[model samples]
Target chain A: LAKTTQPISMDSYEGQEVNITCSHNNIATNDYITWYQQFPSQGPRFIIQGYKTKVTNEVASLFIPADRKSSTLSLPRVSLSDTAVYYCLVGWRGGGNKLTFGTGTQLKVEL
Target chain B: EAGVAQSPRYKIIEKRQSVAFWCNPISGHATLYWYQQILGQGPKLLIQFQNNGVVDDSQLPKDRFSAERLKGVDSTLKIQPAKLEDSAVYLCASVPGQNTEAFFGQGTRLTVV
Candidate 1:
């Protein structure tokens, strides 16, 4: 499993865009980047995933550079409800691959 | 469809006591995982099971912890001689197959006094 490092905390206001970057210096060729959002007292929810370049969904966008050493999760039009911890996971897709989580980036969206 | 289900949302026990938590994954899900999440830290994978067979349990404390999925539908995790450090949330998650997003259940919070 590739270890991930991300900001411990970030601050944002309503209607602003939030970008959380995660660095995995030892990412493997077969690994994919996946993001999850976790609120207090609830299980983490899948946000988006990508192998390289950019992938967007109804919830968020995942951008992986050509090097694949790092990726960014972009959230548009943030609101107070978006306040939660975001986790970046790098792992293989199939064959019962294990997914490990880091400390995660805590996004605090305010009014 | 219903998500993963866990029982006893919270538990409190003394050191050296034993406790068990139950989990029922979504119907027909092939993979189930158990994780321990400490306060202010990310969830750590304790074990993974595929159709009632163990796949990974290197991170689990074998001497003190044990988990089983007898019928590949429901599972249980037990901890004996619990220590103060055992206070954490136990999470259960399941995926439909090898290639799919996992669905997690609201974890059981355990506090060892």
Candidate 2:
């Protein structure tokens, strides 16, 4: 399992772009970086995933550097409803698939 | 398509009592997972099931916790002789075998007194 480190909390205003960075110094070659967003009393929802470089979707964009040690999740045009705890995880697609979640960054979107 | 469904939404029980939570995965999902989420912390995987068989259960406390997904559709997790530390939300999630993202149910909040 790879250990990930990220910010504890971040504050952003509505319509601003919010970027949360995660560092996984021990990431293995087979490991893929994934991010999940969790609202209170709800299960974590997958936002985006990537191995290297940049991957974007309608929800968010994931930017992984060449070194693969760190990845950033960018949420554009944030809304108050986007406030939630965002987790960064590193693991393979299958085979064990044990997800070790770190204390994610609590992103609060202000009005 | 309906997402994962879990009930009862909230459970309050005394220490040493037993409580069971139920989860119904989406139709045709092959993999199911259970997670424990404590306050101020991210969710932790307790077990995973591939259809009706267990895939991974290394983090599950076998002594007091047991889960089964029989017939590969609905599942149940039971904790006997619960303790105060058992207070947390139990989440159920399911994913298609290929590349679909895992969908989670609104978790069951367990409060042990």
lDDT of each: 0.93, 0.92
* Candidate 2, CAPRI quality class derived from DockQ: medium
Clashing pairs in 2: none
Interface RMSD of each: 1.3, 2.3
Candidate 2: what is its chain A TM-score? 0.97
Q: What is the lDDT of residue A32 in candidate 2?
A: 93
Q: In DockQ terms, which candidate is top?
A: 1
Best TM-score among the predictions, by candidate number: 1
Alpha-carbon shift of residue A18 in model 1 (angstroms): 0.2
C-alpha displacement of B8 in model 1, angstroms? 1.1
lDDT of 2 by residue, B26-96 (tens): 89888899999999988888999989999899999999999999999999999998999999999999988
- List TM-scores for all candidates, in order: 0.98, 0.95
Per-residue alpha-carbon lDDT of candidate 1 for residues A16-104, written as tens digits (9 for 90 to 100): 99999999999999999999899998888889888999999998999999999999999999999999999999999874668788999
C-alpha RMSD over true interface residues, model 1: 1.3
